[model samples]
Target: MDKLMPQIESHIDFFLREKLPKSMPMVAMLIGDKTIGQIKEVFVSEISVLFPQLIGQYADGLLEDDRLYPMLTEKLQSAAVYSYISGTQSKLKGLFSKVKWGALVFGLIYGLLIGLIAA
Candidate 1:
């Protein structure tokens, strides 16, 4: 098992870097719970399909090892939080653009009204 641990860690690193984003939407579904079982379930049910060989090889270590599970959950949660923040930032940008345009229009109208009154 010691010999396999490094290999398992390397594989997990690759999975997080390469496949996690692609599977993020599905992984996000399991974000509420931070347990090893939930993390394992998400990986097994969703992420495994994307990289069967990697999951198959390391699934046991990922689920059963105390050290590995926390690492995996931390990575998963960070990804989910990043995705949520990015989505919110995008929405806020859109809203800010609209508000900016509205303010410009309001200013133009107010200026025109003032000009008419002055005239």
Candidate 2:
């Protein structure tokens, strides 16, 4: 049997190759176009050009399906939220070293107010 073709030739790079090695093999062979679309528009465009047959046939199941988009969007939004929250948590963790106990209480109140205002 022939070895499976690399999904995109002349285009793969180190960062993407790292992410892709973990992709489910069955899913990669089949609906991989829509899978790459979630990564970026550039990947979508490249897949369309490089592997039109597979991507075109499975496009709806992978790309246009309602279930897929919502999950992808939620993942994206939650990543952003988690990133910001982790940064804030790190800052707050460091704050404890600098303030006196009474001042820390005021600082916490001020931090909450600042967060509210920023949001």
Candidate 3:
């Protein structure tokens, strides 16, 4: 187990250097939570040669994928699942752009008035 650690690091380094064009961090950040979990599930198979020691960290990371996959699956009903997920931001951009500032202010004021009345 201990010996395989260096081998894993070397393999990852070689992949990052020779195969991946840019840093994985940038790519990973865009992949989202559920897809990341699927990646982990596939990569942790015995054929991948991942060490048992690093398994804890891998499992933890996979489990922490609580970002927004569940919400998107509600609409994905086609063959190009990966493409749909990869293009999530394109369709959902409107959701992030329209901020309910007035509603938020009104809600705050309403809450304050309610608190005052209760007091």
lDDT of 1 by residue, 1-119 (tens): 44555565566555655576567867645444345345555654454355566667798666777898789778987897879998999999999999999999999999999999999
Worst 10 residues of 3 by lDDT: 39-48
User: What is candidate 3's lDDT per residue for 4-86, written digit by digit as tens?
Assistant: 65575566545544445355666755665576456545544542554554687887886777854664565565448768776
Q: How many residue pairs clash in each candidate?
A: 0, 0, 0
lDDT of 3 at 117: 100
Model 3 error, position 43 (Å): 32
Please name the candidate that would achieve the greatest TM-score relative to the true structure.
Answer: 1
lDDT, candidate 2, 1-119, per-residue tens: 01233434334543344445566555445545565555655754665666657657698568768799899888987897878988999998778666667697898999999999999
Winner by lDDT between candidate 3 and candidate 2: 2
What's the TM-score of each model vs. the native? 0.36, 0.25, 0.22
Question: Could you list the CA RMSD of all candidates, in the order they appear?
Answer: 20.2, 18.0, 22.1
Q: After superposition, how far is residue 115 of candidate 1 from its true place, in Å?
A: 0.9
Candidate 2, poorest ten consecutive residues by summed lDDT: 1-10
Better of 1 and 3 by lDDT: 1
lDDT score of residue 27 within candidate 2 = 48
CA shift of 51, model 3, Å: 22
Q: Return the top candidate by lDDT.
A: 1
